[model samples]
Target: MIENVAALAHGFAVALTAKHILFMVAGVCFGLVVGVLPGLGAPNGVGLLLPLTFTMEPVSAIILLTSMYWGALIGGSTTSILFNIPGEPSSVATTFDGYPMAKSGEATKALTFAFLSSGFGALFGVVVVTLLAGWVTRFALLFSPVEYFAVFVLAFASFIAFGGGSPLKSVVSIALGLALASVGMDTISGSMRLTYDVPDLIRGISFLVVVIGLFGLGELFETMQNPAAAKPVATRLDLAGVVRAALEWPRYGVALLRSAVIGCWMGIAPGGPTAASFMSYGIGKRFSRNGPRFGKGEPEGLVCAETADQSAGSSAMLPMLALGLPSSATAAVLLGGLMIWGITPGPTLFSERPDFVWGLIASMYLSNIVAVVLALATVPLFARMLQVPFTITGPIIALVCVIGAWTVAGAPFDLWLLLLFGAVGWLMKALDYPIAPLVLAMVLGDRTEDAFRQSMLLSGGKLSVFFASPLPATITGLALLCLVVPLAGMALKPRTARSAAP
Candidate 1:
């Protein structure tokens, strides 16, 4: 540990140079723009910047990319809070409470809570990476397809059990998402399952397009239908509110810690930030004293979702760095960049290039701090955007949604899909169906199916294979508990009330 600390100090020296700091600022600025624009996510941002880094030194190149990642993460929550649109897939959970909070005239508080918690989560993840890198790498290596499947199941079960709605309705929402996810050609079967003779369907639907339709266009439609709702709600962006929100951080200590732990675990494993955010939000809803107000502009919910999302995104870098396994799409791009730079990832890389490794880690600390400052500075700008007359902002949002949807694949077909799903989203909201579960299912459905099939193949169709190992068995057991306990509580609730009746 002492040696790691010493090396990290040297790394800070490497990352603190003027040239590297400039790169960090530039990367963060560009990334914020990428993140605030739907359909242009971190992975794409990193990929676009990859060619530009080809001439730079490896450490400088990496610091630039990673800084952009932090900036993108912080920026994504801005749209989720103010516009009910997620600039990144992992920001979806933030929209649940963030938009509601902003709509209730607390945009400053929501943005402040999100940025502060995000900074905390990123720092927590970096601390883990600095201290426990070796242990986490080894633990991550223990996960097989069976364990991966179990983890996905556990994520799903947690959401369903604690999602705070009709369990049956949640199930229905999940089923719809899964069905939508399966529209493309089957990965293993080499045949189309749901294309139904449509060539465009062969490539499947983009999750981003669906999200834009559901949250962005859908919200627009609702407002258009009710002109009264189109009137901009009063919102203030003041230093006082930001300071007050920061001061309230201590009140949510439990949520911050829990979410950070969940994010790190999911990042080290294969759950990714999207799954981590959803799982954290679900668990937060169940455990928070403000549980009943989760979907209704609760600050605790914003803290939980943003904390887990940022932590997971940051910790995901560890596996890509130490084990040659990319835990997320952006990490995969970073891994590619490492390979391009002639740096082979694995246990040996740490010993072979401690300077590079530690420098990247140190940069995470600095970059996240920069991201938070820049993100906070923009809170007022985004808050004031909400004050724009709906007639103008609404059309602009719709046009942005349309452009975002078209950018998914440059296919005209996605435009129609956007409108269809927009109407579907409006209908679902009207019927009071939970949208988060559906989004979660859509995100994990394909990965879960692939993992499950691989596990089945390994076990030759025997279900006992999941229990053949301690890790998978424990995770599967926990998933079952998550499913059963909440349902059992619900079942007993009515009985207990009857017994206590006068």
Candidate 2:
């Protein structure tokens, strides 16, 4: 503890410099812009800014990038609450209750709760990263191909089992994602699999393209279908109402703790904030005394979802800082940025560059505080954005999506792909299919395939190799349980119904 404290003090000394503070503020503001925009997300935002940081010192660049990440995570709640749109994937759960609250004229309370919970969760995660950095690094290094594959399996299985939609529809969505993911070349053997002789297919579909298409353009298309969507929502700003909501925090003590833990765990697992948010929201709703009120503008629902989203975003840095492993797409981009800056991120990062390590950690704490304050202070301005008609916002979002998609690889083909995926998203929504699992599967698909192939090669096609290790064994077992439970229930329903009728 003493050593950690000493290191943290050194970190603060480094981070508190004037230039670093300025960078933090700039990054936070930029992140907020990215979050408020419909098509631009954290990964794309960071990617766009990453090149600008190339000439700067590694520490400064990282501080700036990570603070932006913090801002983006918090900023997403703004759109989710004021509008029924999620600025980023992780904020999707917030819309369930947040927009409902806004429509009912409790926008101020919902926004305050979301930002407050985000701040609290982020601080909790940073503290965990400080104390458990060493432990987490060691544990992450223990993961092999088998373990990685099992983890992805667990992620998909959990989503399908707990997604609360038609299980068949969820399966179809996942399968669709996997099939789309396979369109690219086989990395291991350099063999062509699904490329229909198209040059664009050779590079495969980019995750960013899909995300923008599905979440951004898809939302725009959906909004255009409803004439009522063009009308401005009724939103009121009440600082007093915010205070009243804060007083209810004590009642949600258990939920807060549970969500924090869940978010931290998913962060370590590197499942990304999106998964953590959904899982936390599901768990919170399952156990809440006000269960039925969860999606109906419940304050606790916003708290639980936002808490997990923030915690996951913060803790995701742990793996990247300590073990050179990135838990999310944004972290992966940051990893690339670190490499570009001539800093090797791994176990040696702490020992070799203690100042850098600690300073970045310190910045995380500062950034979280700054992000929350900015979010709250700007609530009225952000809430006003909802007053704009969707007719105008829709075209603007479409343009942003086009611009963002083109920037991914500077390819015109990405724009075409974006439109195609957007159409898929619109169709899925019309059919009441859940998009979360599909998105999750697409993000993790490449990793899953790579790990499974590597494990198979190592084991010479022996399926038993997956169960050889304790961690993989446990993860795979849990996955099987998640998958089987839903099927078992479906199978037994007929018998139970017949017996009850008799």
Candidate 3:
């Protein structure tokens, strides 16, 4: 381990190259800008900048993209805390406590907590990715199509598990996403399924455009319905005071450590950052002495949520780089970008492209440090963003969504798709349906379907082939555990209730 650290330390010397450093800076700046805007997420930021990386080397490209990822992970808390609007999905839980603290004139403390927790969580992610990457990669190789499909089912199951108002509504959202993913030409048969006589539909709907519209444009439309509440306004806070009172800061070692662990596990579980953040927050609240303070304004809860979010954001890269599977939406976009660059990611990638992998690992460390500096330096400026009335801000958000949707395909058709998805998003949101399932489906639906069919074909149509291998059998056992245990608990609930009633 010490030897590995020393080698990574050497990698840092390379990360500090004059050119890579500049890209890191650019990423940090761009991240802060985009992360402050409600509904605009890290994936959009990377997609917007993807074309610019065409001329750069692979190492530089990874550094630039990963730096932006880290920066946005840090900067997202600003909007959630001060404006009660999540700039990224991962930061959504932050609003529960963060905004209330800001409303009570503790914006500076909240921001400071966010910055420190994000850096700590990200560092933890870097360490996990560096040390356990090989083992994790090997574990991923065990995933056949059935296992991958099972994982997808579990990931989408979060919609029902987390859905607050109605399980049926959550199922609806997941079904919609799966339906959208079904559009376009079939990769296996070369047959168009749902083009509806349109050439663009033949290629399929880019999830990028749909995400931008649903989360970005849809947010704008939703906010417009309640214009006054959507209004943003500046608030005053004393950074100096917060720093001076640092001794009074919450004791967050346990929270930070716990959230990091939770984030790492969730990232590996394939549910992504949204689940990590919310899960961490829920756990923190459950364990807190002042659990009731969670949504009302609790520093401990803020630290937990923010830490887990950034950790999940950072660690999600591990599966993408090592296993060639995206653990999050942003990683999925980067996966596309890597494909465009003709880079096939997997264990072989580590062997064939050690420099690229090492450089990326090095860049993440530097990016974390840079994010802290940038977030702290821009606090005064970002704090002012809260003051901009929703009336002025709403139009800007809508315009950015328009640009984002248009950029995905360089066509007007995508913009219309944006509006359509935006409506869908708004409706799902209104009905308390979980949005993560839709994104997860849009991401893994096709791959899951293809894998199942291919596995059957390779086995000569023998269903038993899925369980013939040791790896597959073990995976089956786990899947059964995942499904059966949950149902067992549900089934036992009424029996326990009956006994208690007697």
Cα lDDT tens digits for candidate 2, 356-441: 99999999999899998888877666666656676787787688778777766789999899899889877887776877566556
lDDT of 2 at 449: 93
TM-score of each: 0.64, 0.77, 0.86
By summed lDDT, the worst window of 10 consecutive residues in model 3 runs over 493-502
lDDT of 2 at 132: 86
Q: Candidate 2, which segments miss by more than 4 Å at Cα?
A: 1-20, 33-69, 76-113, 227-259, 265-305, 316-360, 494-502
TM-score of 1: 0.64
Best by TM-score: 3
Residue lDDT tens for model 1, 1-502:
7877988999999999999899899888877876775435676567556656767899999999999999998999988887787877789999999999989889888989999999999999999888987676566567777887887787667666755455556678878988998898898998898898999999987665676677656656876776342222333468898899889877899999999999998787656677789989999999889888999999999999999999998998887777565556567567767866788766667778887898899999999999999998875565465455667766865786787667656799999998998898788776666665566566567767988999999899999998887889999999899788867776768455335423
lDDT of 2: 0.80
Q: Candidate 1's error at 355, in angstroms? A: 12
Candidate 1 weakest lDDT stretch, 10 residues: 227-236
* 10 residues in a row with least lDDT, candidate 2: 227-236
Using TM-score as the yardstick, the better of models 1 and 3 is 3
Candidate 3 residue 316 Cα shift, in angstroms, is 1.5
Model 3, span 67-92: residue lDDT tens: 88888878888888877878787898
How are the candidates ranked when ordered by lDDT, highest leading? 2, 1, 3
Task: List the candidate 1 regions with Cα displacement exceeding 4 Å.
Answer: 1-118, 129-133, 223-363, 430-432, 488-502
